[model samples]
Target: MDVSLGTVFVSEIMGTAMLLLLGGGVVANVILPKTKGFNSGWIVITFGWGLGVFAGVYAAYKSGAHLNFAVTIGLLANGAAEYAPGVAVTFASTMVYLAGEMVGAFLGAILVFLAYKKHFDEDADPGTKLAVFSTGPAVRNYGWNFVTEVIGTFVLVFIIIAFGKTPSGLGPLAVALLVVGIGLSLGGPTGYAINPNRDLGPRIAHALLPIKGKGSSDWGYAWVPVLGPIVGGAIAGLVATAYVV
Candidate 1:
């Protein structure tokens, strides 16, 4: 069952939008003031993101659920021939997947902002407000922060590649659990912005949105999340090709 590239693009967008919507919503609920889920702690956020991945995988099933560019690049670096069954792995298709993921993430962040509009206006720390939109480190060291993201993303993409090679009938649920595990285990460092689009797109949204009292988007540290994931994912792909036999 072959499909057009355009269809693949939209599929990714829908899936990723669903992902960010729920994932970001959880953050907003837990961190933002005057919400029922306030102070719900890390477990809720982790599971929310995991469930988000589960839903997103199904939504983008047509595009092999490449909701993150890291996944797409990992496939490419692993010498993949197709993005999905019919979507050939070419430069154009790569661009399409990335574009869809970014747009979807942007849209999803907007949804989260809208959903939590009341909370955002209820007077909160600028850092907390920013956290609702994007990730920040517990510590302020860029070098270590970058390393943490790299290590976390390596585990993410590596395990993801392993998932593709193994058959468990778990499908998207497997990826969801992996995300949860990543968050529980490694998310403390940088909130595990293991996917570039997952971090950057919503970050751009934070900068543009009219959220009252929202402060700096923390653009200075943005490159860490973006580049660390890409590098980690690429390494995972290469290692998977050689080792995951």
Candidate 2:
């Protein structure tokens, strides 16, 4: 089936929105005190991210909803998508997809924020406050933090493309399992901000959202989630291609 540009854009938006809701919502629930999901732990994050993938993919499977930058670049690198037809079309469409994802991510964060607004106000730890928006290491360090994100994202895309076979075959249940495993195994280090849209969009939302004395958003570590996933996904796709070929 031929994919339409409009469909692609809408699917990306919807999928990303769901991702943010599941992922960012979990953070809000865990970090916010006296709430139901408060301190729910890594398992919750893993499950939430897994289900987020299922929900996003389910919503946008028809329109090539990738919901992750790494997947987008990997598809282009492997000639899976016709991104070479026209420069303007390719560039504009890709940027549009990213934009849609950011919007979706923001929407998800907003939902989580609203869901736990009262809790946010009640909570008073700076670290906890930051957790509601973006990820940070259990023990802070520059090198390991980047590595964790890279490894986590690499595993995520590899499974999605190879095991899950999304947008082609397989089902959400399997896709969700792949994510669950990644979260359980690789999510410990940096909370597994595997998708750029998933991290940056919600981070942006956190900055904009009114949360009373919300501390710095950790902009310095921002690029890790953004760049790490892209590089890791590219490598995984190349490796997959070599093996398959």
Candidate 3:
């Protein structure tokens, strides 16, 4: 169904909010002390993020859920050239959707903080506390970090867009499985953030939220998550479209 920009933006906020809620919540549970998921390992993180995407899509379907900036840009780059107004509309819509996602992610981080308040207090390591709400690489090297995120997000957006006619509907299980497959296959190196707003919004919340001795929010590496996904998604879209023969 065709949707106005206003409607799509609202859905992006709502959907991305839910994405962060589940995605961040899982990270918190796994990393925070005195929780069932404490130290549950990478499998949980992968699954939670996968499920988060499914939930976000479900909520945002009515408004056309382009929850990630990469997907929006990829879509624009691939399909917008046909119409003069398409570039402007795509740019505007992407900005609006990204803004909504940021709001949603902050809200989700707030909820995670509330849910795991005791855990944060009990945990003494500042790094652990901050990590629950945001992302940091297992290795601090910039080159690898960017490559990992780029490859993962590139595959994700490419596969999703190439899946078929997106104006058509996907069953809930199909959507969830798409993410799960992405996670299981490609999530080993960096936590797949495919969406820039998802990482930054929650990172902002982590910085603002009251936590005892929480470490730096790691803003230095923030741009990678944003730009990497955009590059990856754009490449994927172009590659996918080019091979249609």
User: What local lDDT does model 3 show for residue 99?
Assistant: 76
State the displacement of the C-alpha of residue 221, model 3, in Å, after optimal TM-score superposition: 1.6
Report the lDDT tens digits of candidate 2 across residue range 132-211: 77877777787878888878877766665675334324467677777789878887777777778788887888788888
* lDDT (C-alpha, whole model) for all candidates: 0.88, 0.73, 0.73
Instruction: List, residue by residue over 1-245, the lDDT tens digit for candidate 1.
Output: 99789998899899999999999999999999989999999999999999999999898888788788888888788887887777888999999999999999999999999999989999899999989878889987999988888888888777877767321123888889988999999999899989899999999999999989989999998998898888888888899899887
User: Higher-lDDT candidate among 1 and 2?
Assistant: 1
Better of 1 and 3 by lDDT: 1
Among these predictions, the greatest TM-score belongs to 1
- lDDT tens digits, residue span 127-181, model 3: 7887777667777777887887788777766766676324114444566677777
Could you list the CA RMSD of all candidates, in the order they appear? 1.6, 2.8, 2.9
- State candidate 1's TM-score: 0.97
Q: Which residue runs of candidate 3 sit more than 4 Å off their true CA positions?
A: 80-88, 165-171
